[model samples]
Target: MAFVPEEDTHRSSNSTYRAVGRADQEPLLGKQLTRLPPSLQRPEDRCHATYAIFFSLGIGGLLPWNFFVTAKEYWAFKLRNCSGPASRGYPEDSDILNYFESYLAIASTAPSVLCLVANFLLVNRVPVRVRVLASLIVTLSIFVVMSVLVKVDTSSWTRGFFTVTIICMAIVSGSATIFNSSIFGLTGSFPMRNAQALISGGAMGGTVSAVASLVDLAASSDVRDSALAFFLTAVVFLGLCMGLYLLLPRLEYARFYMRPVGPVRVFSGEEELPQDSPHSPLVASRPLGSHTPPLRPILKKTAGLGFCIAYLFFITALIFPAISTNIESLHKDSGSPWTTKFFVPLTTFLLFNFADLCGRQVTAWIQVPGPNSKVLPGLSLLRTGLVPLFILCNYQPRVHLTTVVFRSDVYPVLFTCLLGLSNGYLSTLALIYGPKIVPRELAEATGVVMSFYIYIGLMLGSACSALLEHLI
Candidate 1:
């Protein structure tokens, strides 16, 4: 889906804006303006800022835990074809991967669920702010749980203690949203295009790290220990996440999504919180018929858009799991050096990052007709993306099932790199653009919802691909 232009009715103090693609620009712009009420800079908020920084650090630290695929692979691969006793799957071969992912999908969605409920309550009887705060609390609760539950280390026994990994991912994904919105409230909220650049840059940090882990895994004499190092990297990031979150000024959670309440200064944890960023307007309309408690729960902005982004990521992630497991197997099968093994993932990540950067640049510079209107012009780029996405979804990814790319069909290797660039660019654009679809307040919910959708897309397309592999 593409970003809708800001309606003509939207106005802002930033005199730089001209008559945009004429529909109303959801009131996101003027938000990033440095001005704010005196209360925002209060000495009290400074103390709150400390915790927020630590929180961001903790979230970032989770990146290395990579157990999501590393350990999940242990079960998913074995279930279809157990190569040996070592491949029997997690928690004693129960196909437990589903349990963790499913649980993650549901638990991770709590903020989204609460957002939907919050919106509904605002429409009917309850106070929307209460719902928002409650949801935020619940979200952060789960995040902390993860740090404790998921023991991050390099122990062989730790390979599948994914129970902790499961809990940790859910918390990080949700809590990140909880605090991020507050940050958006702080930094004169960024626009859709700019936010994308920042987020891609932020996530790219991890992509680079993932590739490094791949190299380490390949370089090590023992793959098991390498996997441990990988998990530990995540822990370091988690600590970093905590630190970033600590820097934010804690504004009252009341209506942080829509109209500015003041400096809650936070990053976008939600998929999209309406801001100066071409953020979408949440529907003000109430439920139609009798009130049976809407089946969708509380999510609005982040759930739908976040799901879309996450689904795409899932497709991308599918390639990841296959890359590591299959490549090692291929090296053994064909007798090649492990150096290329690291290079494969590293190269793919570079391509994706490159694409993402290009997309952001295009959005930033290509101002439309009436001078430089960054918002509307950037929104248009999302539609033209079909070509690249098609190429990504259709072309087979490079596989190192035994040795190296040199021995594998040359076709797959070349296309794999191309796909990397395409997916990377599209993903960056998708994340930036996705948030503009709903109300600003719901950005956090959107992030996890997107994560859920990402998993679905990955499951649907990848399951089929894997099935084909099974058959062949």
Candidate 2:
């Protein structure tokens, strides 16, 4: 048995950590704390290794998608004049080039909901190791394939290339969804900080990719080289994630929390496990075989927080990258690099990602409005106003909506930052609050369920983005 500090034992009562015995089993609060070998005692995080690893895994979860989307120059070059004869530059008239972001958004998000459902079903049936590692391997393999295609000229087979690229995006999205959900599910067994670390890491992943896009845009002349560099960086990062995941089990802190707790009654805060109780320090663990908890109770418990997460991401997806990327600078006629090439990436991708990172990181220090507060849902609803605000931006080539209400470049910049900051903070609060609201045994499943909410929102939002694009 692992030894938990006295303070930690007290904290366990309010958290999911408790005995994992059969529900019919009586409380063993009076049991004596069995002394364990020094080796088996709970260990420190040792310079926050466990936290760092979870954070890296978070980054790995979203890095591939970010890299894929942020390489706008590469995508434009490949899809340019694809249907017609080989051309030096992308023509403005090309349908694929004009709407590639929308197409890519649809392709990436369409399969995520299904994949998340599949992952939820497999939560009990499959080991976290197998689900996470296999998904990473699949995603890494896809990026490798994409890297190889970077140097290959597809002008003669442009449509085919587009088809293949979309297929690859769909496949990668599915794999990433599984990987992300599984890792997040695993974090349910750890402390709240670990979960926050994972969520913040995801924002960090976006920031890294955004910065990489800017770097490649400035440093590389050829679009192929820029894209190749992007995919290769993802490949290296995925490999590092694989190595870090393998290292996770070796840490004593992780091992202690991840240990299987048998069937125990749910912790309701009214009954405090005795401080000396042997099982009081154990965190929630995923039970094997047919012992998985029913999904209904878990859903019922987390319904509000789940909605907050889903709706938050839904609004985020509705405008970001799809509509946000299309909003051009007001100074496009200036012919300056800042107005021409860097405006969209800087204002949309880089700034948004950085602000998002800041938002998630703030959760590490402060979490307000609590999980059950109605204020959360109110915040989510307030974000809907941003949709129209974005739609009224300087979106070029507008047919149906001719007015640009926020004419200054500062409007998009300010709007994008606000969009990202709100998304990161609100979503992280909801995600971290989810498993805590459920029974100890149901924490992991609840985590997966919460993830389903997010992806389903993303899928619905992605579909709506396309419609909204047409409307604009």
Candidate 3:
């Protein structure tokens, strides 16, 4: 069945048909009707432009974080020899260089959760346009500043630089959270495919960063140059996202779906008044803030799906990048570039992200174990098995639990692929299904709530990852 706006559901059937009949008689109303596809007739995506834009926006959401984390060499270079000579490489004994990933995880995720809470409260208070655009601008500005700092040597000021870098990470992470949540909320009103597109784009963003890392690793000798190029690329993409978002409203397909759905009014012997018309019921029905559905009801409806979403990410974050990145290649003594420079990037970031993208893409074709199906949560729980699998891989510098059961490189590769594929497929399903299970009016808020679940999962997982890292 075609999607109908929530406002149309409030009206009696007879009045809706009568309004449609009367609207057919007026040229302006008829044109508006044609432009705004009928409730029964979905509009064409117009060369899939809207879909592509949403995908790109999805890419924009995660690209910054991906760029930041994947630039391991740059972080190492900057954090290296803070207490020693500048000519020395990253000190193996430096706590900052050693635990930087955990610190980054904490710095990024803590603010993200806080910002998401603020974002959820401000959903109806601030326009989505303001929130999304503002976040994008802030993120772009941070990347620009970061790009500039890449060339400015901070050898003498390593501690200061480290502190500033963490602070910047926190700010950018917060901004990205708002941008991602706002965009996810906006997609709730559109078809499910748009949401899928957004999630798939996020996976693609990781893959893009991984590829960029590999390229930079091969092509550039200097970590600073690679980092500068990386941050500059983010600047360009964020700028592109700003432009594409501005262009979104100009598309008929997006405009038709993105229109505000509110109570409709019937007029005698005239076309139905637009929602913004002076006499429209929406104008006097309630204050703007009152339109926000209470959070409890939405939470009640999607609690199961929310749990699945949160747990899926919790398990993912617990192992990925944190534990997975630390897993050394089994044949490190070979001195080959594959073992030295490319192993972690290839097996961990690139493979996982590519598999994750594949998993997300699979949902567009086949959505199994439907939203209400008990199988969904069951599958989520089964992913717990992946935790020990990753831990048992050849993670290095182990003081405790030093046994590596899976010493072969193939084990990490296979486990990582499974982690990415399952994470991508299951997480995408939970996200897309959350909004659909709620009333259309609450879809946006549900989207925000669902996002909150994801970040909460991330926050908890990031914390646990540190503990697990220490135990291993």
**Candidate lDDT values, in order:** 0.39, 0.81, 0.81
Ranking by lDDT: 2, 3, 1
Residue lDDT tens for model 2, 91-121: 5427777788888888998898899878878
All candidates: TM-score:
0.51, 0.87, 0.86
lDDT of 3 by residue, 1-472 (tens): 1122324422211111112233223211111111222454455788989989999999999999999989888998888742356635545427787778888888889999999888888887799999999999999999999998898878777878889899999999999999999999889877667888999999999999999999999999987888998999999999999999999999987886777765422112233445334223211233234634467656876799999999999999898778898899989999999998999999999999999999999877566666666788999999999999988889987889979999899999999999999999999988987775444456678889999999989989999998888888
* True-vs-predicted CA distance for residue 341, candidate 2, Å: 0.8
Q: Model 2 compared with the native: what TM-score?
A: 0.87
The residue-by-residue lDDT of candidate 1 on 68-118, one tens digit each, is 433333334323223345435444444343333343344444443343333
Among all windows of 10 consecutive residues in model 2, the one with the lowest summed lDDT is: 26-35
Model 3 / residue 312 / CA error / Å: 0.5
| Alpha-carbon deviation at 169 in model 2, angstroms | 0.7
* C-alpha-based local distance difference test score of model 1: 0.39
